[model samples]
Target: MAGIQDHFKRDANGNVYEVDFKYVRNHVPLNWFFEHMLDAKPKPMSGAIRYGVCPNEPACQAASVHSVKVCVKEDSWKCFSCGEHGDVVAAAAFYWRITHREAGLELMRADVDMLKHYIPPKPETAIERDDSALALVLQKVAEASPYPSKDALAYLGGRGISERVAREACERGILITIPNDAFQAKAFLTEVAGKELMERAGLWKPDKKAPACAFRPLWFRSQSHCAAEFRLMREPRDGEKKAMRYGGKSPWIWEGQTPDDYMLVEGPIDCLSAVEMGSKRTIFALPGCENWEPNWFQMMAEKNVLMALDPDKPGYAAVEKLKPVLEAFEAMVGIFNPPNRIGDLNDQLKAMRGLI
Candidate 1:
C-alpha cells in the first residue's frame, strides 16, 4: 500500500494533483480500499475481499450475501451473480457512478497504506479435479433417470406444460428425474458416478457418501448438460430446509436459432412456455435472476432484448439491475409482462390454453 501523503504535491495556492496512473493503480492496496470504501470483508485465504453489498444487484435476495469478490493480487472486482467485472478504477466509477478520470482522482486522494489490519494470505493447495469425469457421471445419472417418467409428466401436467413441449424438452435432455427410491438412486449412482468422483466433484457431501441429489428427484440440466439443478418433488421434510441443490454454475438455457430479437426469462419452464406460445424470438433462460452472465453481452450487442422475468420483487429488482448492463453493451432493452397481470410466462401459457 502506498503512503497517503506522498502522491499529492501542494501548489502555491494549495491545489493538489495526482502524480501518475501507475502510482494509483499499483501502489494502492485494493483490499484496504474496498474494506474502507465498501465495507467488504477480506478473505485472506482466497486473497480477495467480499463486497458487503453488491453494487450491481444491491436488492437481490437469491444470490448469497457478498457474492461479489475483489482479487487483491489482480486489483480487480467481479460480481459472480451479475457477471460484472472490472479493475479498481472501474470499481470506484461504478460505485460512485462517475467518470473514470474522477474515480482515478478519488483513488489518488485516498492513497494510504492501510495494510496494518490486512495480510495477503497464500493461495490454498490446488485440488486435482477431473471435470470430464464429473460430466460423464452426471450424464449417466440423467440417463438412469429419464424424463417423461410418471411423476415428472404428472408434475409437468400440473404446471400446465403441454405434452409436446415436455417431450421436446426430454429429447433435448434438459429435464430428468432421479429415482424416487433413495436406495435405488444410491445403488445406481454408486456404480455410475462412483464414490471418488462424486466427492471430488462436490456432488456428494464430505460426511455423506451418497450423491447429493439422491433424494432430489426433479433434475433440470443446462443446455450443455455440464451443470444441473436438482429439485424436490415435495416440500422439504422437518429439519431439512433447502428445496434445491445446485451443482456447478448454471448456464443459459437457449432456444431458437439466430434471431434478431431475444427474450430473457427466469427458468427453463418459462422458456418452454414461450415456445409453446409461438414466440419467434430467441429465448435464453437463466437459472434464476442472479445467474445472468457478462459474456452474453457480446451475443446480444446491437440486438433487441425483452425481459420477461417473474412479476415478483426479486424478479423486478434483477431486471432493474440487468437492464442497464445490457444497454451499456448497446443492446436495446425492453420489459415484458404477462397479460391480464398473470404471475409469469408459464402462467400466461396456462391462460392462453384456458388451463388456469
Candidate 2:
C-alpha cells in the first residue's frame, strides 16, 4: 500500500499556516476522470505521482521522466515528474479538471459527520457482551415452521425446474409461507410448527419477529442462510389480493469468504446457478445502482471480476457505471453475455436440461 503523510506549513510567526503539497493536479469529477484518464488504460506512471497537463498548452521539450516529484508545501504543490506545480487549490482544480470554486463547492457537497462532536463516550459500567437479543431472534425464527420443502418442490416442478434441482431444493428446506390472517387457528398452528422445526434445524430463533422462510444449510457455519418476510395479503372488498412484487427487505443471501476471482450477477438465482456450477466467488443483486458501496467493490477488486449482469438495458447500464470504479482499482474485468434466450445462470442451467 502507498503510504500517506500529512504535510503542513508554518507562517513566519511560527503559527501553522495550512497543509502543503509538492504538486497539485487538476481536479476532475470522478466520472469524467475515470472516462478519460482511467478507463482500460494503464498510465505510464501507474504507481507514481502525476500532475496537470493541459491539452491545449504548448509542449515543453525539456520535460523528462525524472522531472516530476510530488511536492506539497503549504498551499503550493508541484510534480517534478511532469514539471507541474501550483497551489493546493490549483492542484485540486487541475486534478479534477474543475475550477477552484467548483472544487470548493464539491467539498461542501460532501457529507462528513464527526462522531466525536455529538456522540458521548460509553459509561465504564456499560454492558459489553455478545448480543443475547440476536440469539433470541434466531430462536424465534427457528421456531417458525420448517420451510415447505414439499411445496417448494411442487412449485419448482410447475415452473419446469429440473427434478434434480427441485429435489435439491426440497432437501435443503427452502420454503415458507406468510400468514394472511394471523387470527386464523390454521395460520397460528402452521407458524408454531414451522418455528419449532426451524429451531430444531438450527435455522432460526424466536426473538426476531421476522421468521426464517428459507433454509440455507451453509448458514449453520457461515451464516449464509437468508430469510424473507412477506406481508400476507387478504382479498380486498373489490378485488383479489396478491403477494407483493418481491419479498420485502429480507436476508436471502450470504457472502462467502473473499475469493480470488468472482462473477457478478444481478439476481440471487444467478448466484445460486454459479454456485451450483462451481463458481464460489460471486456477488448477487447489488443494493441498487447508486448505492453500490465502495467498500464492497474494493473487497472484490482484490481479485479478477467477471461481469455477468443480465443481458438487458438495466444490466448493461449497471456495468457501464461499475466498470470505471473496478478498473480504477486495477481489477481485471470481463463481460459475460449469456445466451439471449437465457436471462441468467439459472435459466442457463434449466436450458442445459432441455427444459427451455
Candidate 3:
C-alpha cells in the first residue's frame, strides 16, 4: 500500500471531505485488493482455501506443484515455487502491465484519478462502458428531482414509513414522484437529453409488454411513480401497489459508504430503519428476495453479513439459496426471524417505536 501521509482539503462550501488516499488503501485488506489472483481455480476449495498449484502461472496448474498455499481462512495466498505471492496491492502490482509502484499509486489515489484530464477513459482509449437509454432517463430525472415531494412523503408516512426513510426512498429511485401532467415529465426529459434518444429508449409502452401500459410514450413520465420490489411495509403481493416496471442494472442502495459489514435486509425501507436506529455502518438493502448479483458475494466477501429477509416463504427461500454461497466464503451467516412472521426488520423496529 502507499505509505504516503494523509492530506485534507476544503471544498468551496467549506465542507471538509476525506482525501486521504494512502490511509484508505491501507485499510483495504490485501487479499481483497489482490482477489484477481484467485480468479483461476486449480482445485475447488469448497468451503475452504487450500494451497495448491498456481492458476496464474500455467506451469503450476498442471502438476507436481504444491508450491501454492492459500489461506482461505486468512484471505491470503502464496506460491513458494515461483516466489510470487502477496496481498491485494502486491497481487495487483504483479499482474498489472504498469510498474508495481504505479499500480499501487493508482489504487491509492483512486478518487483523484477520476478527474477528466487526470487519467485514461477517453473516447477512443482506455475504458469502455455501455448505458441503457431508459436508465439514463431515470438518472436524469433523479438528478433533477432528487428530494421527495409532499405527496410522496405523505403517502409513505401514511403507509407507516418515516419522513427520513421517505426522503431516502425518493433519492435512491426506490420510489419516484412525478408531475401529474405526463407532458411535464416528457418535456423535462427532452430538455435534458433531447428528443431522438428519448424516443428510441422505448418510452412508449407496447401492448404486449409485461406490465401492459396503454400509453407511456414519454420516458420520464412512465417512471413518474415507481418502487423497487422490496417487501418492507407489508407482503410484496399485498403491500406494493406500484405497477411501474423498469429493467436494467440496479445496485443495492447504501446510505453508509463503508463496505465492511452488511446487515442484509429485505427492503430498502428496512435498511433505512436499520440505519436510522444506528446500524448505519453495517447494513445493506437487498432489492428483492432473489435479486442478488454474482459480484455481490465478492463485494461482501470480507463482510460479516446478517441476512434479515422476511420470514415468509419467498424470503426464507432466498436466505436458503444465499446461505451456502456466503458460507463458501467462510462468512458467518445468520438468519434473523422476525417474531410471528410479522415481516421484516423495519416492521419489528416500527413496533418497538410504536409507529405501527
Per-candidate clashes, comma-separated: 0, 55, 5
User: What local distance difference test score does each model get?
Assistant: 0.68, 0.42, 0.50
Runs of candidate 3 with Cα error greater than 4 angstroms are 1-131, 168-176, 180-198, 206-241, 255-259, 338-341, 353-355
Candidate 1 lDDT, 251-307, residue by residue in tens: 545567657789998887788788777777888888877776777667788899998
The alpha-carbon lDDT assigned to residue 332 of candidate 2 equals 89
Clashing pairs in 3: 30-88, 33-88, 34-88, 51-70, 263-283
For each of the candidates, the C-alpha root-mean-square deviation to the true structure, in angstroms, is: 7.4, 17.4, 20.5
Model 2 residue 316 CA deviation in Å: 0.9
Candidates 1 and 2 compared: the better one by lDDT is 1
The alpha-carbon deviation from the true structure for residue 168 of candidate 3, after best TM-score superposition, in angstroms, is 4.5
TM-score pick, better of 1 and 3: 1
Q: On a 0 to 100 scale, what is the lDDT of residue 2 in model 3?
A: 32
Winner on TM-score between 1 and 2 is 1
Please provide, for model 2 over 278-320, each residue's C-alpha lDDT reduced to its tens digit, 9 standing for 90 to 100.
5556444442233355545676555688887665544677789
Which candidate number maximizes lDDT?
Answer: 1
TM-score-best of 2 and 3:
3
In order of lDDT, best first, we have 1, 3, 2
Q: Report the poorest 10 consecutive residues by lDDT, candidate 1.
A: 60-69
**Residue 162 Cα positional deviation in candidate 3, in Å, after optimal superposition:** 3.1
